[model samples]
Target: MSREFEIAREFEVDATPEQVWDAFTTGTGGWLWPMDAPEPREGGTGPFGSTVVTWDPPHRYTNRVANVEGIAEQTLNQLDYTIEPREGGRHAWVRYVHSGIFVEDWDNQYDGADKHTDFYLHTMREYLTHFAPRPVAFTTLDGPEASKAADALSTAVRGLGLAEDVPAGTTVEVRGPDKGLFPAVVDYHNPYFLGLRSDDALIRVFGRNHWGAPVGISVHDFAPGADAKADAAAWQRWLDEVFA
Candidate 1:
């Protein structure tokens, strides 16, 4: 017996249920992958040939993906999200499951989607905690070496002799090619993703395997009165140097 490709992840966010719901439904601007979603009316057209399956505020929502713009024929991918309030509604727990079938190369497709799940969730947490309603400029750059292995990217990110993973409590100086040493904390870490929360930025490295494996670097800056374009360029230059 065989099973279709499916991925599920749970997240504990330090925000109210309402906040979390808004983050997922709004649009890419709200922390989800970059895509456009209309008002989310049932039976109405949605982004990428999707239909709103369920829309219960502050609780659960579902979307059925029939046609992903570029991808070939497939029955459908069900995207379901369930949110539960924790600690008397002070914080929330999020569960996201993306279930679908792949006709071929399941490993590569699953691997890419699994890692991306982490990246997007972390972005959501960052948005609810730091960036929020004040808009974020998300930029991503991919390279051949970056996507090959998670360990390799981890080694590069642990620059300046930092450990393979940042120390638990010790404040260590981490340096990037473009931006020298900056005070940052290792917010989340797993084999597929590394998230660093700096004073004014949220930096992440994703180990993804699209049809071809490629490493992805993303930066979300929340500096006061910041320039999105300039920030994106700086991060791109840094990626070049790191992967060079």
Candidate 2:
């Protein structure tokens, strides 16, 4: 039997409605992973081969997908984004909903998706408030099976030399593949996710083990001429070493 789920969130970003639309629509790598541009207007193509049901520019956008791959036992998936101007066009209030149906592993899948939305939205605010003008190169890597343990998140946190309950604004230095250190601030932190912001990048670490998945990391680079593949490779190597 399949069960339905809805994950709803409301937040405000220091950006206009137009800027919010661009962030959720065309500004792929800025807050989320990079992908093909969605076709504009109602009934047009949308993310993951979905159909755009509503397309009021700078206000509301929605899409529905039927029977997508990658997710197990998924039936129908829909995403809605409603934006409104706040502070007289300087900030935008956003309402987001991701609803879907899943079978058997409902609890695990729901846990994973529900928690991930917060981190992504937090990243969206970071992009709009800080790096909206810069182009982004994004990539993600999953840790090895060893990262599936109950304590995998703590392991990775310690591997990065961060405390289990680190606070926002704390600075941490992460070593790149070349052994050079890049300092980043703890922009957001919770039990299941870690967000870091640097001068030219945003880093998101997912503690997916709690939801029955391997840990993962996504890097959003805003530097000039950023390389996604190289960034992924470096992070993969780091995860391998961390779990080794």
Candidate 3:
């Protein structure tokens, strides 16, 4: 079965289309778009490929992205912007058209398309609105230290009996199933965790599971370098009360 869906949303940004175009075209600002490496040029290879189909200053800019994962082996994702002169300035209308069959499965394709559209629009908004240069890092846990941490966290999760307490709060705005479903007791390898962010810290609570049963506990900690002990204790108490 073949299925297709389209998502279109508009945002009233504080910046003009010219400014928006520049930010998107510039290498430094392109990260907001989640492009691997965006090199804006009429026909120069970059995230999408070589060739700028349309580059009408401020008002419109269009490019084609080839080989987008799961989509067309050579697909064209076009972005068009229109600026309408308003009371204060120009109101921008950004339209994205993705044409390619990246996936054979209709469900997967629709889901991927939905996420891509959302991310694209969100990145645009972030750039034009709350542009923050936050530090992000990635690290893998391995060896003995990693094992110890995992064990401790696992133990804590088991002790908490988390399955009983429903996780309630604002969903993690990040994309993915893990973000949408929280406080759910899942399988051992796919346990549920809660993510929290504050002005001072970002916290991740790792849940534990036995077979497919959830033990209502999680090992909580502030982002790397911050104290975990306090956060862990706090999470423990919270879980205790929640389960109680």
Best by TM-score: 2
Model 3, runs deviating above 4 Å: 1-7, 29-41, 69-76, 83-85, 132-244
- Per-candidate clash tally: 3, 0, 10
- 1 versus 3: better TM-score goes to: 1
For candidate 1, what is the total of clashing residue pairs? 3
What clash pairs does model 3 have? Answer: 42-51, 42-52, 43-51, 70-102, 71-102, 157-217, 160-216, 161-216, 162-215, 162-216
Candidate 1 C-alpha lDDT tens digits along 13-49: 9999998888887775545545666445656555677
lDDT of each candidate versus the true structure: 0.70, 0.87, 0.41
Rank by lDDT, descending? 2, 1, 3
Q: Write the per-residue lDDT of candidate 3 for residues 84-200, one digit (tens) a residue.
A: 434466555555554443334556555545654554455455435433333322111111222233344344334334322324443323211112222322222222343333333
Residue 138's lDDT within candidate 1 is 63
Candidate 2 C-alpha error for residue 30, in Å: 1.3
Worst 10 residues of 3 by lDDT: 138-147
